[model samples]
Target: MAQCVTAFKSMLQARLLEEKLASLYRAGGRIVGGVYIGKGQEAFSAGLAVHLEKGKDVYGPLIRDQAGRLAFGEPLLDTFRTYLGVITGPMRGRDGNVHRGRPREGMPAMISHLGSLLSVVNGMLFARRLQGRLGDSVGATSLGEGGTSTGAFHEALNQAAIEKLPVIIAIANNQFSYSTPNSRQFACGDLLDRARGYGVQGYAVDGTDLTACVSVFSEAVKRARAGGGPQLVVGSLLRLSGHGEHDDSSYIPDQVKSSPLGQDCLPYAESQLKASDLITDEEVRKWKDEFLMEIDAALAQASKEPTPDPFRENWRALSTAGLVEGQFEA
Candidate 1:
């Protein structure tokens, strides 16, 4: 229990980090309309990220906020640049919504067509298998509850299962699809059962349980490494905000039921830690203050991030090699 407390407090700190990054992105010069926040669902993102290898594993992230990306070592300015479409971004400011984000050391760049990218991951798996690089590689995809209804979900899951590919399909069911609720979305009480049809291993965990989430993702990582194909993890996370920018909270129906705002995975962990003899209240206080300071520092430094390169407007044609012979000849 004490150990759980220690791990728990750290989990809260991670959530705080994510929140700070979200705020920075919202007001940042770049990524004005591209602010993706994982405020209530910190556990699954931070926990799973902790277990996977940054360089070897490729991530397909739709939850495009700085926290998730930062876990993989992405700098604040670079992410801002990516969101704002600046040339200085890792993807040369070319990556954006549906633009498989800048290919980093560990994760794949964000590709807009989420479901189809599974095929790309499978192709990478096949290549790795043929090259005798037959080790573990987790290709994580974050899907809201609404995505499961798409034919793409069925197709991606089926392809991975048939090929016995190494992928972990993580469904972050924060429970709302645009304006509709989960019941309106699916009859299945949990999304885990849906993957069973494809012979995929499935687990539906408490999205707020940080330790549980980490353990499950770690196991999934292990199985994929051992040629065990794919695992479907539908973690029920708390949603603190609506779908995206420009959304107003006045519309969310109250009688239909709602979660407490601070029902966040990280704060929950912190409270649990305080209840037990983990590190004493002082430790928690120290960590919280320390994390806040780091966030302030990140915010301050992020402001100083260089603006996107001015001469990168031709970035698209250059990166895609979509050049025509003598097209730019003087």
Candidate 2:
């Protein structure tokens, strides 16, 4: 009951923050680069993140992983600071929103190229193996359904299987990659079948259901931790918002987008909670208010962070320790 409440709290906070970012972007706030929301996939990411051992297991979170990242201790204020280009924030306002991670803390920042995340995480897992600490480490990463078709995804998965690395490859099969739907992406009935070809275990999950996602991810993480090798997990969900705030996501079908069952993960979880009698309306309202207040305070503080100083920022972007005198001039 406690874990379920925490999971719901994480999801609610993630959803609210993403919506806040969208609102800020629309209102011409300090947001730079793109604004992507993990609104519909909150349960999936949060489920996987909560199962991993914080200081021991490593994972790379994509843009749609705000909840998971937050659950792992990424500051909500830092998230806002990254987008607002605050000098006092992580990335020193250098890396843009959600493109940052704390490697020392086991969260490798994700690259914009979604397909590359798998290989990067696999390498980290491989490094642990080389150090003979493989038993102590497990890795997880995410990609969209479209990314599975990329060469990097196949190569990484193939290598992980052959090496018997403890890595979990999570694919968010939201049926569409940006404007392109699954039909145009691949002919395969399910992405999980690719796991068989690679000789690893695979699980297809209903990403919206927090209980199911958390259970599956927990099992996979435990198996990997026990030296059972890598697992491929595919999550099927809907992209409630656009690929970015700039996009209206009009390409998605109206019926699918409008369907509460398909569009929102929160309500699904709420229904489950209600059915189980695990929560009351008053409790839910209290939790919601708490998260909103927390977020409001974080954002308020984040907004006060000033932009980086141009002169001080230039040297910060590139270290001068090993550079030649002439190189510094440029």
Clashing pairs in 2: none
TM-score of each: 0.81, 0.93
Off by over 4 Å in 2: 258-263, 316-320, 324-330
For this target, which candidate reaches the highest TM-score against the unseen true structure? 2
Residue 44 lDDT in candidate 2: 88
- What stretches of model 1 exceed 4 Å from their correct place? 1-14, 21-31, 64-68, 83-86, 96-100, 255-262, 275-280, 309-312, 315-322, 325-330
Reference-based lDDT, each prediction:
0.64, 0.83
Q: Report the Cα lDDT for residue 9, model 2.
A: 74
